[model samples]
Target: MTSYLIKSILCSGILIVVYHLFLEREKMLWFNRFYLLSALVFSLVVPLISFEIKPENVLKPVITAVPQIMEEMQKTGVINSMIATAESNSPPDTMQLLLFVFDGICLLLLIRFLVNVSSVLRLKSRCRNVKIASAKLILVPENIVTYTFLNNIFIPEKTFENAQVRDEILAHELAHARQMHSLDVIFIELIHVFLWVNPFLFWYKKAIRLNHEFLADEAVLKEYTNVKSYQLLLLDTVLQGRQMALTSSFNYSITKKRLAMMTKIKNLNRQYIKQGAIAVLAFVLTLTFSEKIYAQIEFKSKEVAATFPEISIVRFEAVADKPAKKPDQKGKSGPGISKAEIDEFYKTIERNTTYVKNKKGRTDPMVRMEPKMEDRMYELFSQMDTDQLQMAADSGIMVFQMPIPVKKAPTPEMFENWKKPEIFGIWINEKHVPNSELNKYKYSDIAEYSLSKLYGGALKGRIYKYQLDILTNEEFDRTYDRRANDRVIITRVGWVGENRPKSFAGRRI
Candidate 1:
């Protein structure tokens, strides 16, 4: 809101300067009036008009390890250091207090404006009205100066005794009345009530008043051939015209400019050039203003990422240690396996063994064995058919066959239950996902997967490993794993994809 006001003031100032340079002495009163009024309206409205144009392509930046430091700081609740510093250094509610002060000033100015308007209305009620030609002259009983409000011209009763002076003053005030210059005065006065703090508004009011005088002087001179005679009359009645806030008076201390305009010759060529320049200037300002408005209104995706940096999973691995075994107590033979028990255990293993098809579609041995142990294990399963071997593979492992079946590929879900290392951590797009959620996804649903080591800040020399799995459409198919220490996943749904480009120059590290 404050920025909008500042832009409005700047635009208005530029327009006023243009007017003074080009149209002020052009002799086109109505055009000048419309231009000034339009300038005011344009300045107020231009800041609100915004146009957003989407580029055909948007480039994405590489998420470097540097931003990982910000992610770590955020996790530790220390990323708001700048905000903490600002709060500690600055006064609380300072901006709010300033706004309150500004509002108070505007209110006071509005009251003053209303009071001045009411004073004019009161004066009009007390005056006596008499119609002369087309103007309704209001004769005030007090020994005060002359001024015109709307269609009524107010003058002192004592001034009526001098017929010649009265005629000149009436002619000047009548011009103001016929042209409806009081409306302009009231319009500026109302604007002043709200924008009283703007110094330009004060000067703008003076410019408006001076222009009104120029217009009235032009109207009066159209009838009277003697410009010099009119100048003398202006000099004489200048002291007789009282300045009023909401009315156009015969004189408002702009006598010299008015007299000078009367004698000044119009230059058509110079006027045309200036008008062209002003038009071009206005066009350029409008384009610039619209761009500013668009910048304020439009939201950038990159900025959102900057505000909340993403935390990618860099690596994932299973825990290496197995459960500890109980210590055996000293006895005659502590819990020695009996020959019958060994036979039963071997029988149990043989019953459970099965052979399953591997990735090659071959029904290999259900369990892997050393080259030397392979023949011995095969001898036990020599009579077994491919189907029987496959069934044995499906069942699990046998000791005499082999200790365990060929290792089945792990699914996304299996990784969830797999014992994770105590120091291992995982994150998906800056959010922590529990093992429960991680287990729900299938491996093939992942469009891209890799392992990487993040390095920066305290992690500069040290490497923190993680796994990055970017899903295609959150669905499942087959399972496969390929390992890369440092990799990028460009998937359609997550990571760098269609909307996010490969590289962006404007990205902040």
Candidate 2:
């Protein structure tokens, strides 16, 4: 995941950098603009459409079978697998992660909005300190509204008094303001934020900014009378520092480019139709392959997803909550777990703390077991409905949701020494864990392991540490803000494959 994240960032960064280079050149050559815009649109649309094609409900059917299948396998000590999907993350979890990514995006957007608003407020404050020259500046009512959030233009009152050059400057900057190029610039900045890792994205920002200046220059030049004077005025103008997010200004950094753009010789004989066609083609070409970085990245992650990233043996522990449902609502346990499926979930707490009876000659009995409160709850959790899971979650009974770290994935070569082994006979020394020393077969000790094997996954060699606490509504709500780290340890981590013989028949069965 970390590698993929870094790669995605680098991909976006490259795009931004390339864009910056294009902007520095100060001319799009018609076709360039076509490609950039088209590519941006395509990149945005593909992921959304891909989601619908993949569908959100992809995991529902498999999850529906987990409990019953686990039960049967646990009961009969048989391996039950019809269609085993290799481990990636689940679709719901993936969707949640994507939402989390978007949440981060929204937070960034909000930060920008606040920063802009704060800057505007500061600007408003500066209005009182603003110095006005009564003698040197005379325009339409002393304030000509010369610039906006984008062009970042300002006249030193000395230059504004020149009536001849004034309107041209006003018109040029106005062109930028009318187009809301400042907002465009802000949007570009945000693109850089998301795609900053992509160097081309950095370039894209510069290119787009320059394009705005060019577009604005074209607008004013078409209407101004003395083109040479206007060009001279632009060339003499000092470009100011970039302003806050929402300011339009004149004298933006790309002034020389803007001046050069004005020098382009336009002739009546020049074929507009031919230029238009070439521009269109150029745009189409660019659009088809504009997003070299991000698109390439998206392709890589997809290809990698197909292979075994990790062997995720997912298991869910049932946490208790909710009142009893009608008997009809609880489906008959499919094979192995149906008998233990009776709803003594809470009362079984006493039975849970009791130790397992591994008497002489019992068939694969989990002799030593001390169940934690949470693990016991998880035993019951596998039996609950999705609605019940939600209720439990809402009612302070958290289902300790866990997925193994993606970092743990090992290569096929690494597994060369590993053997192909089927997990069987999950035993817990309930006498050793969180509860207390135990005597006879307390149902919870053996029953919980049975439940885990039946529903979650076969846990023969592994041990987890689980502990649960009964929290009030207030406690739950108070800590709800940060639940990511919270978990009830199941079985304490333990070694596996130490005692069991080559086969159950050879051991003691």
Candidate 3:
């Protein structure tokens, strides 16, 4: 909302400057009227236009290593202390307050607008109707200047009674009525009520009213012979009486400019040049005030793997023509962890594990550390290549050990319990299967299975917290174990063993 308002103000300000500089002094009255009205409408709409910019450069997909957590512990005593500092103590919203103040002022302005309309209607009802020059004239008894409101022309009783006053005053008000200038006045005033804070609105109101006066003065000059005498009449009505907000009054502070414009000679060539300039400005502003969007392309298959070798884990062939950036190139390279930093991380882990076991007496194997494990861990880091090392640095791994739980040979009852509806989801042989299909696989047929927690607790409107995956012995040896032929290697901060050994699965000592 704030961005839209700022853009609108900027666009209107620039267009108004162009009007004052090039078009204001010209005798192209109708063109000036069109420019002012269209400028306001265009300012509010141009910011919504958008253009999408598609770049030729392609971006490589980055892969991250993840470690699964088996269990977690927290202190329940801090719950009350945390709840006491919730959002209730936060500060009030500034935008809501501003909207409230804006609405209040707009409401007041609307009431004042209604009161002005009511005053005009009341004067219309009390005046004695006098038909003059094929239009009904309302001879107002109050001491107010001659003004036009919608189709009604209000003339002061004295001005109507005076024999000396000519029909130029009547002619001016009738032009306003014929051209329906009251609609423009109402439109701008209502806009002013809502956007009262914008400084450009004041300038807009002044320009629009001045343009209306110019049009009316031209209309009067077409019917009358002498332009000087009409200028004198405008001068005499300078301080005639008060004017209503919703009406086009005869008297304006810019009387001198009106008189000068009447005698100013029209240049047809200059008018055409100004119109062409306005067309160019509109085109430029449409481009300037619009939004720009960038397009992204996605790559799939083995082609991606050969092109983006630095991506670490490539699943597709190399088919892209553009070569990937070299690791030594001076662009955005991945973070590198120093030897000292790795040693600090090891010390922090050792300290925390020792504290948990000694102080809390926790016997969970996941939290326990094996003896002389740091030597094997440091050796794993030393063998990694540039991409592997950079990926490890970016993962921000906190713990150094990850353990996979092993279960005994499964029974029919155990297999039945796994199929319960209480579980979040189940996958058999890496394919999601229904519950009825689970009856076909016996307990002895199962080779390996794992239960893992889902970080996104709920997905696609289902309450999912944990996922269970099972692999039949046939599927395990034939596909699962040999799946590494594609060489999708992942780097993690932990002990390693091949095929997940009984104690530490991938631990290479």
Which of the numbered candidates is closest to the native, going by highest TM-score?
Answer: 3
CA lDDT of every candidate: 0.52, 0.39, 0.60
Residue range 387-487, candidate 2, lDDT tens digits: 44443333222222232211122223212211112222112221112122122223222212212222222121223211111122343345444432322
On lDDT, the stronger of 1 and 3 is 3
How many angstroms is residue 317 displaced in model 2 relative to the true structure, after the best TM-score fit? 30
lDDT of 1 at 129: 80
Supply the global lDDT for candidate 3: 0.60
Prediction 1 global C-alpha lDDT: 0.52
What's the lDDT for residue 397 in model 3? 25
Candidate 2: Cα lDDT at 458: 16
Candidate 1: tens digits of C-alpha lDDT, residues 411-447: 4433332224222234333333433455565644334
Kindly list the per-residue Cα lDDT of model 3 for residues 422-485, writing each as its tens digit.
3435667756555567778777887665444333212222233334567677775676433333
Candidate 3: 10-residue stretch with minimal lDDT: 65-74
Q: Mind sharing the TM-score for model 3? A: 0.56
When summed lDDT is taken over every stretch of 10 residues in candidate 2, the lowest stretch is 294-303
Candidate 3 wrong stretches, greater than 4 Å: 55-92, 131-135, 161-165, 296-509
